[model samples]
Target: MAVGRPRTFDCDVALDHAMEVFWRHGYEGATIAQLTEAMGINPPSLYAAFGSKEGLLKAALDRYTERRAAWMEEVLSAPTAREVAERMLMGVAEKQTNPANPPGCLLVQGGIACGTGSASVPFELAARRAQTEEQLRDRFARAKEEGDLKPSADPAALARYVSAVSVGMGVMASSGADREALAQVAAVAIKAIEEQSAR
Candidate 1:
């Protein structure tokens, strides 16, 4: 029997690798050659699996959304909203400061690049932002219901604030902000929440 080539294609792994490349360099900045090289596959193989770079990015965005939602679920379900908020901020802080991973959020970096270059990507990014904001608002609403947040505070507003901070942190991380600085910024948010929740 003739020996066949070892199986090297794993769609999941390839998509993840592609995602990271797009995450680091954004869509327009990432060339097909770069993606293929990073994915360890030929152009034909990548195109066959992912259709095109845009298709691959959309799929990757879906994966990221699902993964982030799962993580948010865990954070939101904490015993107290204070714990939830702190943990959420801590997670962001760690991600920002972690040298092993990409410096900033893939969506935010891509959105910035895309908004200036293409019309469609901005809408795509907006939809993603809306989804994320909804998820965050749900968590904040739960916290409010549990009396972990001030009765007078608006869950939507708080969620928006948290989201804003997260985006800022992503930018700061890309700009080489230190862990201590991230933690300090996170602490400010946490403190504000604590004060309100205490009311």
Candidate 2:
């Protein structure tokens, strides 16, 4: 008997599906069956294409990282540090509050769950966070150069602080915080960044 030709999977589409499944259910919660089903592929095909569930997740994260960079580019293009921070914080707040997105950042959610459970997860999570921080720092640095930020502002520290607040808001959203609560939290965070930049 001869083996039939296998159907080809669209790598990008499959990864997007995987990302959504993992984002919805989380790492420990999402099963291989769920991933494969959502991706419209079988176990053998999924494994053949991506090696393992973890491998697929890593690919999904890479996709997400690229998407984030694109978004950051838009956010950082604002005229002032306050505007940039507001743009990002408001965007996050909207997502966090939206019933559609369900308030979880994929990387942040995965990091929180996997960071403590596995050896490599924590490192990957840290790296992801570092990447985000670096982008924010760059934004802040540029704002300072344009006099949008005060001369005394510390871009590195501001970056760390803003990222922490953003991640914290995601956790809050996961914990059942409503849109009003998230908006309040976002406002406070953005205000703090602005006030500090002024000094």
Candidate 3:
């Protein structure tokens, strides 16, 4: 129950535009007309290609996580839990301030100004964030099993702490915090992990 595909527009290119639009405006604020306008596609074409506004948002969010959060996956490869934490913290400090990309993070920004109309939007955004935090928790749990972290260390708490700091960093970045400030914040976060992991 949709329309024909356009010969002139590329899905990937339009998705990139939609990602920026969604990044600038939170999930609830992004309108279908705005999305189609940014994608240079009509309503039926958009529906045919993406199913609905929410579907298009899901696509844009996937693209954003793949492209922007690649560093998170990379950090998970570090040899130690401390290394993983530090690398992830530092990476956020660097990327959140990149002039080339939109400030803050798509994962965190999506729910910042979330409203009641599209209840699923906040749930989707929160789920993505929770998924990342769960990764951190798993990483820390493994570290504990491997004796890198203390046997008594609560992986969930450590993961939540790091996640909270990361979210704060995103908020600060969106509020115009510079790279140096974010770096200082990252240092503080990494230092806390270092102090605890040393135990």
Who is ahead in lDDT, 2 or 3?
Answer: 3
Model 1 stretches with alpha carbons more than 4 Å out: 1-8, 115-117
lDDT score of residue 78 within candidate 1: 74
lDDT of 3 by residue, 1-199 (tens): 8986445789889999998878777787778888889999889888888888889889988887777467777888787888988898888889889998789988877766766667788788778888889989999888888888877689899889988999899999988999899989888888877766745
- Model 2, stretches more than 4 Å misplaced? 1-7, 115-117
Candidate 3 residue spans exceeding 4 A from truth: 1-8
lDDT (Cα) of model 1: 0.79
Candidate 3: C-alpha RMSD to true structure equals: 2.6
lDDT of each: 0.79, 0.80, 0.84
Report clash pairs, candidate 1.
none
lDDT of 2 at 140: 89
- Give residue 18's lDDT in candidate 2 (0 to 100): 88
Residue-pair clashes per candidate, as listed? 0, 0, 0
Top-TM-score candidate index: 3
Could you arrange the candidates by lDDT from highest to lowest?
3, 2, 1
Candidate 2, residues 63-147: lDDT per residue as tens digits?
8888778777888788777877888887877876677664658777765555344557656767887888898899888878877
RMSD of each: 3.5, 3.0, 2.6
Q: What would the per-residue lDDT of candidate 1 be over residues 14-55, giving only the tens digit for each residue?
A: 778888888888887888999999989999877777787788
